[model samples]
Target: SERIFENEKVTVDTIPLSHRVYTNGFLFREKPKELGLNVDAVKKYGIDISHYHNIKKGKDVLLDDGSLIPNSELTFPPQKVKSYAFCSDTAYEPGIIPFVSDADVMYHDATFLENEKHLAEKTGHSTAIEAAKIAKEAQVGQLILGHFSTRYTNTDQFLEEALTEFQNTSLARDGKVFEW
Candidate 1:
């Protein structure tokens, strides 16, 4: 695994994937955000905009009169950190479980149906059930199946196969936006 990107907002990591050619799957984890401002509390305390940054950073607010307001009274707690994993064009590899574990959302290669295991193996792709097994083992919140081959038309079987293992599975479509 490798840390490919990092910043205040999010961090990105890459995990090696099992494929005919060398491939890397990406994991994205959003950093804990600054606490949200309590507008009512700010107004009650008569705090100015200049203090917003520090308050959101969880620092106590000190009034001009010398009284200090606790950070809890000044802002709301930060929301849960969200994580996303994208694993594509790879065979079912257990090594990726840790990197994708507990991710809020995961988009993985589900290139073939269960009946096409041979084709999937030859192509270094995963069947719907295989993808779901990985997601279930990793305990991901949601699974998105994509990178489909042209040979398949009806996707109901794919979803059906995957749903057997992971209930929170969805088929990826063009322009579909999924957020945690």
Candidate 2:
């Protein structure tokens, strides 16, 4: 499930002339509920959400032992994502790997180089090296990093660091596009 924290501005809408709805938002929230939904946007775009899983609340997800979780009353089988991009800033999070693994394309936030790791962490962000680690674990075919901090005047350092862990990783610009 997408775990949206307080103060996060999450939104979902269908796009015009598409069979699948589009999702854009911060990485913290989950989008299973919105993906593939046949909404106004989808109709406008000629898209469909029939393949997307609807959201469900969990009941007794935690087990008595606390170490194991009972069946997630809440779960969405991964639909045909084709591509998945996690945006904005976030800290090193290993837990997200399962959710993003095997995605055709994955976008992760690499806000800083290694030297600024402490500052990154302090601000709830991640360094380029850390973002690559997540991409590697996720095994995504392509990884695009973005959400740069203003202080970063050059991005070569970010690319170098990310390549150390994930060879397919690259930087994202304001208006770049990738066709599946």
Candidate 3:
């Protein structure tokens, strides 16, 4: 799915202002030797995340570790960067704030309401309220909620729930442009 786009690529590091790196997971794992960069370089840029990979292991790796290996050096340009974090179907992980802090925009999957919180956790997805909580804690410029659960007939509830925590929140539409 990440490989679907090979256009307009940039780097992502632990800091909001560091020399960005390309999508290492799609680039490195597929053709590292072809690119003449070692797989280690991808790890250096905090690209090959294990949290989403090892979610079933019952380990809060992203929490204990901040996306990158400790003591690693990765510098990315702070300016001229648009960080898009597709936190697809994840539980409430507060530790991720630092890594995603100050993103120009963030798309968090809000698939349930507070009343259906149990379903959210069970499905490995976050409630609209939780998504707002993350956007607020991360201090992202804007929060876009999507991936609505099938049970939800109207998307207004998603916006309503998120607004309770983060004021700058909006429901994601099929085709839309959110200017910074």
Candidate 4:
């Protein structure tokens, strides 16, 4: 249940999950860009604004004094793009493992405890353990368990359960801020 929308510069994937009816999760990613001109290097080389675009596109620039400034000297290496995946209100879906593999951060549904796994399955939700298993299998940098069931009074158990499989697992709460 995945649909992909892509162009020359970006790709957005919508993953539809099985809930009581149908729900979708999205993954957004940026395409790699050409080497960009280093501002300091541009200033050092006394390059004009007109040649800035050319240097960013990896083209050498010709100086007014009949000297050639190599593109390598004017531009910096491209930066690595970070990726994130959000699994919204899904069951223990192994099918999505490939799409979200090796993501920098992953947020998955953890709506119930292991004791209530039957209810979680019936409602098309996942327990903390299930979410952690998915994170482990995907090899994500960080695993965030969210969407806890309101029936639970203490949510610390969710984090504890998730930690059994993925040491990097964390429980998400309202107003909680996560930094990469």
Candidate lDDT (C-alpha), each: 0.93, 0.60, 0.62, 0.86
Considering summed lDDT, which 10 consecutive residues are worst modelled in model 1?
148-157
lDDT of 3 by residue, 80-163 (tens): 545566565566667567666777678777888999998876766678998899889989888889889888789898898899
What are the runs in model 3 whose C-alpha is more than 4 Å off?
Answer: 1-9, 13-80
Q: Which candidate achieves the best TM-score against the true structure?
A: 1
Per-residue lDDT of 1-180 in model 4, one digit per residue for the tens? 454787887777886665787787777666787786689988998888998777877899989999998999988887766677889899988888887888878899999999999999999999999999989999989998999989999999999999999999888888999988
Worst 10 residues of 4 by lDDT: 1-10
Can you rank all candidates by lDDT, best first?
1, 4, 3, 2
Clash list (residue pairs), candidate 2? 2-30, 14-41, 16-45, 17-45, 18-45, 18-47, 19-47, 19-48, 36-49, 37-49
Query: Model 2 over residues 73-143: C-alpha lDDT tens digits?
Result: 23433354344546445677776676666766767768778998888777767788888898888788888
- Which 10-residue span in candidate 2 carries the lowest summed lDDT? 12-21
Error of 3 at 66 (Å): 50
lDDT measured at residue 58 in model 4 versus the true structure, 0 to 100:
82
**Count of backbone clashes, every candidate in sequence:** 0, 10, 10, 0
Q: After superposition, how far is residue 136 of candidate 2 from its true place, in Å?
A: 0.4
- Residue 120's lDDT in candidate 1: 93
Could you estimate the TM-score for every candidate? 0.91, 0.56, 0.57, 0.82
lDDT for 39 (candidate 2): 39
The per-residue C-alpha lDDT of model 4 at residue 139 equals: 95
Residue 104 error for model 4, in Å? 2.1
